[model samples]
Target chain A: MTLKAQHVSWRRGGTLVVDGVTLQPAPGSTVGLLGPNGSGKSSLLRLLQGIAKPDSGTITLDDTDLALLRRREVAQTVASVTQHADTDVDIVVRDVVRLGRTPHRSPFGGELARDERIISEALEHVGLTAKADRLWHTLSGGERQRAHIARALAQEPRELLLDEPTNHLDIRHQLELLELVAALPVTAIVALHDLNLAAMFCDTVVVLQHGRVITAGPPAEVLTPELIADVYGVRAHVTRDDYTGRPTVTFQPGPPKGEVLRPLQASTSVRSA
Target chain B: MVVGEQGRALNALTLPVAADSPSRRERQWSRYGAASVLTLGGLIVLAVSVGVAVTLGPADVSLVNVRDILLNHLGLAEIPVRVSEDAIVWQERLPRALVAAACGAGLGLCGAILQSLLRNPLADPFVLGVSSGASTGAVAVGMLGLGGSSLGLSGGAFLGALVAFGLVLLLARFASSGTSGVILAGVASTQLFSALTSLIMFAFADSDEARGVMFWLLGSLEGMRWNDVGLSTAVVGVGAIVCIASARSLDAFAFGEDVAASLGIPVARTRVLLLILTALLTATLVSIAGAVGFVGLVLPHAARLLFGQRHARVIPATIVLGAVFMVWVDAASRVAFAPTPLPVGVGTALVGVPVFVLLLLRRKGRA
Candidate 1:
């Protein structure tokens, strides 16, 4: 049940995108991979999902190298929901979820009773049972994200990887989606953009900068204002949410020092006037 | 074991009672029932279409006479029939109609597979330049006498189609290796081959050779025989089996390649195998029936509109619909113009453009 990446590094077109990173997510925990743009969060998720191979290091599941296992064997245990999973095919929600059963079924076999039960349960788990037959094109962004999660769930995977699953979602939906992911029984490694959301939902958070891990620990310790400013180059105030007892990040409206523009200054002056 | 875990998690929250709900189960049944009924209906329509179309030529062969010829030929019944009517039904029309049906099914299946594999709705054999390459190959053999001694026109066309497909794949790989890249490369190949074909015809072919090549290029089923029928059916049959076997792989590809890889598909291997299969299917059909347009481009969308987007259902539906559609189109083209038969490609375009425009307009408002 162990999924570990030891000293993993990957490059794209001669540029290093994920550098010398090690991640070993504990079973049944929600771990957040947080970083700014081009910080290698998505690339790390890709490596963990076995969609991309690390150039220099190894990713192993249950002490065996992922490169040595067959793709179907890996997929039966790990399901992934990509950040921008959209399709133009005139497919329904249930049909989208049916794709999760691909690794489990043979090439020509029909859907078995067990498959149907699992698919139904997955949809139900995501609170999408009523909208199972709705057309995918008609779904809202939040609903589409939920449908993707349900599709991942339908794989009956022990480990789930999600890449920015809350992007384009409204605040409430973002909270609800994270809550759902956090409560899931499987170990989940999520790449997220929202620091507060990551802090609220993730048991532990790992921050990356320039494709290298800058900090990794419980969100309360890792998501400090100094760390946020150093990694993201933005000033932010961090506080603990009284209700949830989690770190909350509030960003400063103005730009950082030595980068203040005329338009921003004028806007501030206008607000004062 | 995991079900109990999921159950416990849901029990901790406000759980819905829809897990294994009877209503959802009934809906699933109805969906499958509808698909089964449609498939059965399509098969019946295709069979009837071939039979009725065989009776539509200038030979005055009746439906009963055509059926009797088929039955007699199959050794099912021994009904005495006129020699001319028997010849018309068995020797000529049946083979032509069957070949037309096979071409339609094969082309449509290729289109369906490409649309999914490439993640683009406009993907088809013609769009990928396989038909155009086949045309060029056929013309090169027929006009310039290149490879005529060793590879016949069909063989030359098959080679040319594979070459064009390879060129498109290489160009797409060098440029972007995305869906748009493949389609753009296909466009470039199509234009390049079409120009080459024209150059060959203009420079080398005599008027008689030019006229014959022109008719074939526009897709004619004028003199098809039983051998043609057998070749087309066997090719399409094998291709269909292979495609159906990989239906889950195609389903996984509904999203982009990255998502498909996550689903445990050997993305590169599956894509290359299917792409080559489509190329072979297109080349064989093009060599048999010439470049019949629009069936490949139009039938898959029609099938998706009728049935849902599951490749398991969509592929079979497209095959059936395309076969039925081509049989009628060929029959109409044959009988409508009397002595000077209209090209089957032109007939398809005439029908296909309106349907294509309708589908476009319908999707204009959707996301």
Candidate 2:
């Protein structure tokens, strides 16, 4: 139940998109990966999910190198929900969730009673039980994201990786989705842009700048005004909430004064959003 | 913990459980039962269609006679019959109809697999340029006499198809990657091979030779013997098994390659194997039947409309629908022109396009 990335560096085309990054989240904890665009959050998630190997360094699950394991073996331990996961195929909500059982099912074997119960539970967890028979194309964007989460949950993986699962969600769904992920009894590494949401939900927060780890610690410790200003090139007011005792970040109205922080530059970085 | 409690409260309010509904296992079993019934029924219909179609044509053979001949050939009975009737029933029509069924089934399966693999609704067997390559090969042998009589027309066509598929693979590799690149490469190869076919026909072929090639290109089931039936049936049978076994892999491809990889499918290996399988299947069928057109393009969609989109069900359903549709289309084409015969490809398009348009409209309304 351990997933660790050691000195990982990944290059896309010619640019080092994920450079010398290391992440080791405690088991059964939710870790938030926060960075501006092209800061390697998604690329790191890809590496963590075993979709792509880091150019240098190693990714391991319980001391086993990801490359050494078969794809099925990796999938049984790790499940990922990609950003903009979509399809034009005429599949229903339940069918999408049923796909999560792929690594477990024999090719010729039908769904067993156990698989069915797990699928139902996953749908229930995502609050999609009522729309279980709805066609994928007809779902709203937020519902689609929930369906994807449900699909990942159906995999019953020990580790779950999600890239911006709340992008299409409204404010309420954003809170609810994060809450759901946090409550799940599995290790979760979420790459997100919403700083406050990450602060409220994540047990630990890791910040990336130029594909390098800037800092990693408890969100209250890591999410400082200076860190937010340095990483995102903006003035952000950080305050501890009286109720939850977590950090809250509020961006200033205008751009920063002088060259105190440089806005993210357009680069030849080939990290797909 | 308050946030978590709020989330739980929201879930309780919004996500009601359909507690009394049938479990997914029960639903899947029912679907399987339905598919089994459909397969059994399709098999029955296919056997009946072949039997009834064999009795048709200029010969006045009866359904009873066709059955008796079939049973007698299999050593179940020894009913006395006239030699000409036996030749017409056993030797001529039976093989042609059976071959048509096989071609239909194979092409439909190929279409279903390609559409899934490419994640495009428009993909089909001919999209890989195999049919055009086969055409060029047949023309080169028939018109230019390249093989002189050793490498027959079918063999030449098969070789040509493989060459075209190879060029497509090479072009897709160099030009770009992914399914779109392969499709574009296929288009380029199809145009190139089609030009070559036309050049050979116009430059070297005599008028009669040109007409003969034209008929074959339009797809004819004429003069089909038992050997064609055996070859098509064996190839298609094996291909169907391979496709059905890859059903889960195909299902994983609905969200493109990256997601499929995340789902634990070895996307590269599975894609390559399925693509090569499709190319070989398409090439073999075209070489035998000269690129019978619309069945490959239209039948899979029809199957999806009837049986939903899962490949495990879609692949088998497409095979059955394609076989039955071709049997009837070939029979109609044979009888519609009296002494002269209509090309089977043209007949399929004439029937298929309208049905395809109807399917498109129906699908659009649902969406």
Candidate 3:
């Protein structure tokens, strides 16, 4: 499904948090949103997920205005794995995932067999089948994040939005999670602070600075060292890996302030100019 | 690793073992076990309380005589050989016991709804000042002689509860910060309404009608009639249905407000409807049996311990447990001072405090 945001701008208490940013993710592809802290990545994600309304702009899913759909209808199409998913109740993993079926179930009714099948499939997809009966509070941070993903998966949504899905994951689990997300046929938009991981996994990249989209294209085109330095105020070196053929950005110390900008192109002749 | 050990321990503690289709069977068994135990325990308590309560009246009716009286009334047996014995059991103790049970269940149901709506384990109809507000209205009618006709104390209590509850909700909305804001509002409104009740009582301190006001405030099941039972049952019945219908919404609230909203729950509307239902039920109970305390506060938590945190189970379990607890408390109050009648509310407070303390201590240990 095509998820498009057109000139979306949002303000919080007179401060512009998301300035006229437009994002259009190719249908059924993984798009990563990369930004430094306070660059309004989370705010933009919320706007796309319909958790927050844009101050002035339109978000549409396949030509249907998102604002026109009921919250449940929106939820049926777009599932989210947010940063703040916690509960005090002692619910089991299966039951927690089953809550994703909330929009589909009738009020005060038991889940049908189809709902149960979907929940089982979600648990299996996240490799949490064995932990299905475990209490949520007992799970580790990584396990909890996976469980949240499993819940979103159970929604059977066409599009998934994840905010910092690898926040607490170790390297192996992070790779496994991103691989699973990339393998899924559904469209996905993920926000990440780790540019290397984004480069490795995201098919398209949207870079944000001060709540504005600075550059968006394939990762190799948009993730140049000069753009990283300008957006994040960090000097970085960029190189291509022989094995993966993907651009790898490595930060390097630069000259003191007021010195000439060291252009970090692959050709050393340009840097010596 | 310690994490692996802890995970294994949790798995063992939470999972049950079985044969064919082991995991599925285990899950089914655990759920069934939980439901059966709570149901059986509540029923046993109710039956024993009814038996003992019927036998221990001022006349010293025997257990056999109590049974005969009940059986004879139902036409399963001949009218117990004695007219006076039948009268004591049939006309007096039976109605009062039924009223106590109904009142207890009503309070418990209200408590469960309040806890879920506010997302505060400490919330209950009495603590939130709903009962106090209702009592103020009942007192006004009984002492100040407002509603001087057929409508009586109940009408006054209902009106007062409606106003107090409405004000609490309005204040909570105006504050609108979330669960904490609503809880603080309840606390403030409770104090305000309680002060008003005390002020009204003092204004009529010298009047003979003050005695009725004092007794109502203390809460009593004395002089209860079949009509009171009918009224309470009708109101509580409606409240229970409303609470059950809102169970899914209540479960949603457990994850907090934003999540519930994302799940398509109209949080504000559900909360408002619940507050109104609880207020109406509290008013009905107060008008009939006065302001019985503690049952509402303790029963829901006890129900949670027995049934887990699912509202579908908690709501019904609380109602049953509440009824049983109140019946026993009423029975104990009736017999504790043989010839003299102690108010049922005092008995409930005395009984409920220790149990509540025990539950709290147990929870602390688990934590």
Candidate 4:
């Protein structure tokens, strides 16, 4: 399934938060959204997930317009793991995950055996099988994040949209979660604050600045020191790892006095090392 | 292979499985059994409450006497009894007890549905100002001497409840979010209705009118008749069935609105249905028993503590527990002061306050 955003723009409270941004990810590939705070990465993801309507253009999945589908139908095609994770009710983990089977269920029918099996498989994938019976409030923050992902997996969608999935997680869980998402067969669009983690896991990276796609391609080409300094206003050194062939960005504190940064490259480049 | 064999053995020991064995059918049975047990318990409580309430009245009637009178009345037994004794047992005590049970069950079911719909544990039918609205209506009829009839008072109370509910829904619509908006609207409507009630009472300050309004506001099962019992029972039955039917939607709502919508639930429609159902139940109950409070606010939470937060369990458990609670409260009101009866509402509040305080203390402790 190919997911594409076509010249999408969105405004919130009269402010154009996302403007003429487009991204397309191939089937079964992971695309990472990289941006500084207030760069509209989350807004773009919400647009793609059909949670927010684009002001100008269209989002499509496999050539089908997303606007034509119902909310539940969109949910079936693209499951979301958003940042707001607080639940008012106290429910057990298994029940929370079982809610993912909701879109597939008829109004009066109970969860089928196949649905239960899928829920169990999702829980096992997240290593939350043991915690399935635990109350939601009793779980730690990382566990709750994993539970949210498990819920998304329970939707059994063809694509997953994540907005800051690792925001509240510790370092180990963060790496584990990204690694897991990287291995999944479904196409994924993830918004990340940490550039190194994004570079390490994503097959493609799209960098945003002030609601526009400043650069888009492979991580190595887009995460260069000059690009980082121009978009983030931070001086950084870009290097390559010999073993992994991935771009490793290291910030090189303060730029020269009164030396203005260069503009970001208009065309994206895909480099192999 | 060994684990599979063990699982089969356990299954066989539990129940014989034929070629037609379907786990889904078995799971459905389990759900039925759980609901059945709660229903049976509630029925048993209802039976015991009726017996105890009848026997405890000032007429010096025994359990055997009460039973004999009931059986004779039903044409199952022939027993000679004084007409006044029969009157006290059948006409006086039975209607009051039935009204209390019906009111309790209605309040409890309404509370459970409201809490789930609003996603606020503190939500109750009265919290939205329905009871105050009903009181205002009842007081209006009594003060204005509008026909001086039971039907007039009941009609006035129902109208008050409907107006209050309509105002709350209209205000809630202005909120940008769902649950929080409803709660804020409820708070605002509650204050408005309460002030209106107070203003009405002050405008008609006759001693008799004031006492009548005060009694209705406090809620009472005194002077109940078969008409009141029938109204309350019908309302409770309808409310309970509607709440049970919506249990699955309530479960979905526990996750939040966005999630609920994504899960194929029509969130706005379901919320409107719940609000209307609870309002109707509250109006019926207030018309019959006056503005009884706390039962609807507290019983559902108490039920949640016993059964988990699953609405399937919480809803039924609340009905049973609420019935038992009200029956006992009415009995205590009759017997606590012997010849002089305290109002049933006074008894419930006196009891509900301590229990509510205990629940708060426990919650604080847990926190």
Q: DockQ of every model listed?
A: 0.40, 0.41, 0.21, 0.23
Q: How would you order the candidates by TM-score, starting with the best?
A: 2, 1, 4, 3
Tens-place lDDT per residue, model 2, A161-182, is 9999998899988998898788
Winner by lDDT between candidate 4 and candidate 2: 2
Model 4: CA > 4 A from native: A1-9, A20-24, A48-74, A106-108, A111-116, A255-273, B1-24, B68-86, B144-151, B353-367
Poorest 10 consecutive residues of model 1 chain A by lDDT? A263-272
Q: Write the per-residue lDDT of candidate 2 for residues B1-367, one digit (tens) a residue.
A: 5566546534432354464456755876886788799899999999999989888998789888888888889999999988899999888899999999999999999999999999888888999999999999999988788888998889889999999999998998897578899899999999999999999988898899999989998888988999999999999999999999999999999988878888899887898899999999999988998889989888999999978989988999999999989998998999999789999999999999998899889988976
TM-score of 2: 0.94
Ranking by lDDT: 2, 1, 4, 3
Per-residue lDDT tens digits for candidate 4, residues A22-110, read 88888878899988888898889878877678999999977888878776677777788877757868788998888787777655565
Candidate 1 colliding pairs: none
lDDT of 4 at B40: 95
> What docking tier does model 2 reach?
acceptable
Better of 2 and 3 by DockQ: 2
Residue-level lDDT for A72 in candidate 1 = 88
Best by lDDT: 2
lDDT of 1: 0.86
lDDT of 2: 0.88
Chain A TM-score vs. truth, each candidate: 0.91, 0.94, 0.91, 0.91
Per-residue alpha-carbon lDDT of candidate 3 for residues A37-57, written as tens digits (9 for 90 to 100)? 878889998898777789999
